[model samples]
Target: MRTLIFATAIRILTPLFLVFSLYILLRGHNHPGGGFIGGLMGSIAFVFHTLAHGTKQTAKSYFSLTFYKYDRKPHHNNLSHALRLLRKNIVRNKKEKPIFIWNYYLLRLRPTYLMAIGLAVAVGSGLVGLVMGKPFMAAYWLKVKIPLVGSVGTPLLFDTGVYLLVLGMVLKMVFTMSKD
Candidate 1:
């Protein structure tokens, strides 16, 4: 389903989507839009990009940008190189003389990590209220003022957690389905 029009639109619209999502996330407390909605909006950019290009191409351009290619040599096994080899997938053509290896060491921005960190942030936000002798998940505001977001609070943190969780979940699903 790759179309020239769609690809062009994606390239132009991706940044807009991300910026709008952030805006929604930051203005969530007073306005209608919040972390969950913001997260969905944010994930849509990448999902649309994936649809426009493809899984492999999107991953190569974004996720797995840095990779290594190597030929099958016996003596290339050093400590750091061996560690890299463990995460490599060897791709070969018909003759198989020149093997292409994709190393995953540089792909630190994984969806699972986002999910875990989001969950932790959400829970920790609730725990903050508990530690202050308030009920769990209660709102607790800090006495500082920020420019865009204004007062910092537990609700904002919880919203952020929801945003990350939703973004990661949707991206994970998109990536998983794209693989098939």
Candidate 2:
């Protein structure tokens, strides 16, 4: 059911959707559209790509575009390589025992770890505020100037945690559904 025109249009539009999603994510703290909306927006681009290119192609493209360098080399005995192989198995479903084990690890364990990290980050941000003798989830800001991006805050970190959690959940769903 793939259309050339649809595929081409998706290829062109995906980056724009991703960029716009990031914009929404960053601006969410000060305005509307926080991590939840931004994550949905980002997932929309991948969903569109899946519709246009099929799940396997969409998953491959999404991983390659989003992650760096690991997909290029398959033989590297590293954690990233292992993760890449796991992702590959999600689409391809390799029949070998070792590969199946890896696939199980990736599908079952990795998402949990990601969710845990997201929770830790989100809670840690609030804990920082609590440690500072403020109410939980209180806003904290540092006026130090970093090049390109000036002035950072704890809200951004919390938003980032939300972003990661949403992203992991969305991707886990996508991968699981796509496997069928």
Which candidate comes out best when scored by TM-score?
Answer: 1
lDDT (tens digit, per residue) of candidate 1 on 26-108: 99966554999999999988899999998776666665545465555666667876655555534324653423444444554
* Per-model TM against the reference: 0.72, 0.64
Off by over 4 Å in 1: 31-33, 60-105
lDDT of 1 at 147: 92
RMSD of each: 8.3, 10.8
Cα-based lDDT for every prediction? 0.82, 0.72
lDDT of 2 by residue, 1-180 (tens): 478998899999999999988877787866544777887888788778877877677655555433223233355778987787778777774565544322111222344455677778888988888999999999898888555444568887787778767766876677677763
lDDT of 1 at 57: 69
Give, for candidate 2, the lowest lDDT window spanning 10 residues.
100-109
lDDT of 1 at 138: 90
Total residue pair clashes for candidate 2: 0
Candidate 2 displacement at residue 40 in angstroms: 1.0
